[model samples]
Target: MTSRFMLIFAAISGFIFVALGAFGAHVLSKTMGAVEMGWIQTGLEYQAFHTLAILGLAVAMQRRISIWFY
Candidate 1:
């Protein structure tokens, strides 16, 4: 994908990351056990990191790193 599209995807993913995090912390915490909550938290962290990686890739694409990135 192009850098612009990658950025848009990253924005969407970031929004999802935040939304799911809030849902897990506020809503799931009450019902889910500590272990389950921990797992969810770990998954969210990974999502957040991956979202950042997407942003980085977008920047790289914008810089014209390679034709293969297009």
Candidate 2:
């Protein structure tokens, strides 16, 4: 159950990840200040780390817990 939840969570996060990257680059780049954009970038980096960690957990569960965990 946890594995399934993580997989779905990761998928949603991945979508948001791409959307945010595009938004930050194309939209925020023009309107925002450098320091504000830097902070946004930092937060995005942290979010990427956590999303990847969730993906990793899903992979681990597939291998270690059960092949059908997903």
Q: Which number leads on TM-score? A: 1
lDDT of each: 0.93, 0.87
Clashing pairs in 2: none
How do the residues 1-70 of candidate 2 rate in per-residue lDDT, one tens digit apiece?
Answer: 6778889999999889889989999998999999999998998998899999899988788667554544
TM-score of each: 0.88, 0.83
Off by over 4 Å in 2: 65-70
Q: How does model 2 score by TM-score?
A: 0.83
Superposition TM-score, candidate 1 onto the true structure: 0.88
Cα lDDT over the full model 1: 0.93
Model 2, position 68, has a per-residue lDDT of 52
Please, what are the lDDT tens digits per residue for candidate 1 over residues 1-70? 6899999999999999999999998999999999999999999999999999999899888997765654
- The 10-residue segment of model 1 with minimum total lDDT is 61-70
